[model samples]
Target: MPALKINVHFGGGAELLFDKIKKREVELPAVDKYLPECEKKGWTIRELLVWIKENLLRERPELFLQGESVRPGILVLINDTDWELYGELDYELQPSDTITFISTLHGG
Candidate 1:
């Protein structure tokens, strides 16, 4: 199985939850390795979230996720475009794609 190379980014305080690294270049393994139950043939944003929580997230998972998706205040962009325009979690990932997460919530 070939790996998919993609860039992941965090900003607007979201990077704090990810060890303040801000950006990462990742290679996703075969679908069966991370998302065995997936019915789809390719990797999707839905599966990527799970992978992140397991492999990349360092702390405060709640601040980044809600149920199987991102918390409401977080903005997700795929290759510089809003993820909503591409089907949100169902968006299939492509090689070299850039996925960015920006937190909209703030403290007083």
Candidate 2:
């Protein structure tokens, strides 16, 4: 299966954790269409974070991740909307989704 493509934006110093690159278009890699959430739901935010850490993260992961979730104070938005309004890490990914991460801990 082809990788799932999505847009990622980092802001509020979150870009610093990603080598200062603020925007990225990433193909979530896998031979199978990753559907970790109830099969048809496709990749969840939880899985995406793991993918980001292993593939996109450039520096200290501690600043971006805490256990399995994004560290506290880091806000996650899916398609310009808050993840909390959805199901957070359990939220399934859709094609062409725009996921953004903003670090409240930086430049506050």
Cα lDDT computed for each candidate against the true fold: 0.93, 0.86
User: Whole-model lDDT, candidate 2?
Assistant: 0.86
Q: Candidate 1 residues 1-108, lDDT tens each? A: 467899999999999998899999999998876677766777899999999999999999999999999999999999999999999999999999999999999999
Report the lDDT tens digits of candidate 2 across residue range 1-108.
457888999999999989899998988765245543434436779988988898889999999999999999999999999999989998978879999999999552
Residue 85 lDDT (model 1): 100
Q: Which RMSD values do the candidates have, in order?
A: 1.0, 2.8
**lDDT, model 1, position 59:** 98
Candidate 1 whole-model C-alpha lDDT, 0 to 1? 0.93
Worst 10 residues of 1 by lDDT: 32-41
How many backbone clashes are present in model 2? Answer: 0
